[model samples]
Target: MSAESKPLSGLRVLVPRGGTWGELVSKALREQGASTVIAPLVDFGHTSEEDKLVDALHRLEAGDFQWMTATSATVVDVLAHHQAVIPKHTEVAVVGEATLQAFEAAGYEVARTPQDGDNTTEGLLKVWPEIETDEVLKVLTLRSDVAKPVLTEGLISRGHDVTQVVAFRTVGVPASVHIREDVQSGRINALLIASPAIAREVAKQFPDIPENTIVACVGPHTHEAAIDSGVKHTAEHVESDMKHALIETVESVIDQSDMLD
Candidate 1:
């Protein structure tokens, strides 16, 4: 493959997740001439366990909560299902601008957001001190089942009454026949994994991708998951955002593949 020929001209890319973030990555790969296949390895849905979240909202209405944290846009979607509006008194803290936009679209305002950095638990905690905790400080965390307890533990360490509510659950989608065929036939040249859950599901479905297949991840958490799942060759941190990370990873892989050929 020459520079004129390009590295990803005939490459097939597999996107194991489906969401606004995943769509962004897919679009970028298509623009680069990669045959993008969306297998949607994970599905997110609101669970029937809303009583705890409803009770938390009641507490927020009673002015018991000081801050509410939403780690992902899916969290905002699940939260909106229970409460029509988030209490104006309770400060909203989120991880990404997309999450903040979702909150705002749902008629809530975000007080703090991690614009820079890895957008991980540690990044959110660095801005935690700015929040006042003179009162009981109810910290309601709307998250998925696969979410880590790091944020909750950090808030507790800061003397806040942290209540983590499982707003949504991540269900693994079995790999489709087409995806299986693509993998078995060695058509997929790269795998773009954005979430840890997706990485786990991919590992389960295609236990051994072709040795030439490139493994690219969005952030440190996903990278750790990929490594744990036995994905040997991984891309470095491109950006905290999923779309940019995928784009950069694809470009890098294309460059490397071109060099090798």
Candidate 2:
């Protein structure tokens, strides 16, 4: 394809998902002709905390919990690694389809999931009360270090004994010299913030991004973080999911730039 025909030709985008997720976003951006940079803001690794997770599994098998929630697919993987089992009687809820799929693959039935408009905590809360309250509901929440407390706090407010576990830690990856050089030289046109954690890390590493660069956040939370960090132009995905939102935001940015020409 000619350079002019390429969707993101002459644009450079940075993706900071911090692991396999970053790779997925990077690959998609590259296919669209955006020079992609992968700078993970966190790293995932197994830790001795598996014991606590194992204990949680025991609680699950004993039918001690009424509901289980997973925020990330990585949490599901960590649960599986510890051989966590979901009791047949326990209901499961997840933030995204990928997490639901992971639960299904692990032989658990998903009781609730966020639909098109309900991908946020507020969206999930609309249907949360429908769950039986008399059943001594113990909610096992699996997440990373920097997860939002909204979900767990909400569950607790509704009379659920919520056990929130940090399934993994988010550690920043040391940026390569090339990434720093490109970013400082104003070659990076836009930075895609997939999560609030990544956005915070980016703000810490590069306190002063070029004035002309655009900031596209995957969701409201990340968008807020970007704004808090003093990013001038910020956009949130109409759709809640990261992949779709990132692609749509990138396309929108490209279209708007073309219109200005």
Candidate 3:
């Protein structure tokens, strides 16, 4: 497609949080005629409580838990790295489509995911009772170090026995000097906030965002985080394909700007 036909043409979008996902999103943005700067603002690492993780994984593989829950794809990576196995008897529950895809890619089956537009931790909690329908269930909830205990607490409130484990730690990555300068100087047209952590980093790193610049988030939950972090001019969507949703948000903002011009 020609640049004139592309909605994101002449726009420079910053994609935070690197890895396979970043590369794919960057590639799609390029195809849509947007210049992408892949500056990772957050990353995942090993958790401090290794012994607890090991024991949890052992019990998980031993079929001690009737349901295993994953909130992020990073949790799936951590499980795969430790060669954690989910026995056939134990069902798997996930929050987002990305996490579900990660589990399927890692040879694990997903038993439940939020079908509604809300794909946050609370969304999963909302549908927990309907999914289980039992008096009580043994659930193994895995999450990042910075993740909130909403899922665990919700399951417990529902009369389920839950073991919440910090599968990995979320670490912040500083943007390069050039990237920071471009952002502050308004050279970058928009910023992509993939997670709440990235939103916090963006708010901390660039307190004064340019008036012309836009902030697009992957989902409603991330959008809420961005707004809570004091990010202005932010947009978000709830869709199965997060990349497409973000791209659509950018396109919408650009279209709106064009109309005003």
Q: Candidate 2: give the clashing pairs.
A: none
Report lDDT (Cα) of residue 58, candidate 3: 98
Model 3 residue 53 distance off true place after TM-score fit, in angstroms: 1.6
Q: State the number of backbone clashes in model 3.
A: 0
Per-candidate clashes, comma-separated: 0, 0, 0
* Candidate 3 lDDT for residue 157: 77
Off by over 4 Å in 1: 1-11, 27-35, 45-50, 58-64, 105-107, 132-136, 217-261
Candidate 3: C-alpha RMSD to true structure equals 7.3
lDDT of each: 0.66, 0.64, 0.73
158: Cα error in model 1, Å: 2.2
Give the alpha carbon lDDT tens digit for every residue of 1-261 in model 1: 452355356667887755544455567676665678878888776555677767876776677777888767676656556554566788988765446556777778788765354555577677666544565567888777766666787787777788888777788889888788788677877777767777787788887677666667655677788779875553442332433535574443222101110
Best by lDDT: 3
TM accuracy, model 3: 0.72
Tell me the tens digit of each residue's lDDT in model 3 across 46-99.
889888999999998888989988777677668778988789999988875556
Per-residue lDDT value at 137 in model 2: 72
Candidate topping TM-score: 3
> Judged by TM-score relative to the true structure, which candidate is superior, 2 or 3?
3
C-alpha TM-score for every candidate: 0.70, 0.66, 0.72
CA shift of 42, model 3, Å: 0.6
